[model samples]
Target: MEPNATTNENLNLYEKAENYTKTSLELLKLKTVCSVADVVSTLTSKIAVGVVVAFFTLFLNIGISLWVGKELGEYYYGFFIMALFYLIVAIVIHKTHHKLIKTPIGNTIISSILKEKQN
Candidate 1:
């Protein structure tokens, strides 16, 4: 009888451990899903806003280029000036991209993934 009781206790312990492991795995899966959803949603919204801003910038630049050309008495000259401006801007961005873009984006992604649930 004592041996049978010992065997039953061992079985119960095994079952409890199994259940604990399953629960932990489920919790991990849930947290992963939550994090991915949060990141994707945030990115989607930001991209939408970025698209709108990009369009605005495009039209604004076109208008400015036209006005500058009118003032300078040549459309192509205005475009050349704008192109030169952009070339300088591009060079500046290329020089500082790692500091201005890469590090901030990497940190944002890491922080988003590791951020705890607020509720």
Candidate 2:
């Protein structure tokens, strides 16, 4: 082939490669945006549920405290007992922080991303 022909072929090949790269990059960006959106949605729902559950637990605790006080005939002692129970729970949660909180959260995020990819 002529030198000019070879140069033209090389240019065509380079153009193809550049087009391929652009397409790949666009696909990557789309996937990343989708993944981020999924994560944000999941977190939003989880946070909402957490807030609702927190309110429920608060009222439940208060009710139990009042009941305990009524049974024992000392109003504030029930509250103290409820507080002690919470303290113990807090300590247990603190000790198992990774097992109870971190791992599950990480797994949830990872699974959400992976699930998005699968779909």
Candidate 3:
């Protein structure tokens, strides 16, 4: 091959390698974004789950209130009972947040973030 042709071929290979490197970097960045997004999605879904559980708990309280009202013949006492139930549920959820973090997926995400920070 002529000297000029050989130089052109080398330049072409260099350009291709640079392009590949750029693409790889872009993919890594995308993966990092996705990882962060996964954490956020998990957090948002957990919030939605907590809301659903709370609503169901409230429904149970309402049902209990209705039942008790029928038995005691006083609708107002049921409100007090429901309040107590709400208080108990709130306390239980507050106490178990750390416990929930021990689940497999949660632990993985937490460990990943911690590792990232250490690096």
Q: After superposition, how far is residue 3 of candidate 2 from its true place, in Å?
A: 1.9
lDDT by residue (53-108, candidate 3, tens digit) is 99998888788998887788898788778788779988987888677645766677
Q: What lDDT does each candidate get?
A: 0.93, 0.94, 0.82
User: Each prediction's TM-score against the native?
Assistant: 0.95, 0.90, 0.55
| Cα lDDT tens digits for candidate 1, 1-119 | 99999999999999999999999999989999999999999999999999999999999989889999999999887888999999999999999999999999999988999885544
Between candidates 1 and 2, the one scoring higher on TM-score is 1
lDDT of 2 by residue, 30-104 (tens): 999999998998799989999999999999999999999989999798899999999999999999999999999
Pick by TM-score: which candidate is best? 1
Preferred candidate (lDDT higher): 2 or 3: 2
All-Cα superposition RMSD per candidate: 1.6, 1.6, 5.5
As for candidate 1, its clashing pairs are none
Best by lDDT: 2
Enumerate clash totals for all models, in the order shown.
Answer: 0, 0, 0
- Candidates by TM-score, descending order: 1, 2, 3
Native-referenced Cα lDDT, model 1: 0.93
lDDT of 3: 0.82
Model 3: per-residue Cα lDDT at residue 1: 64
Candidate 1 lDDT score at position 115: 85
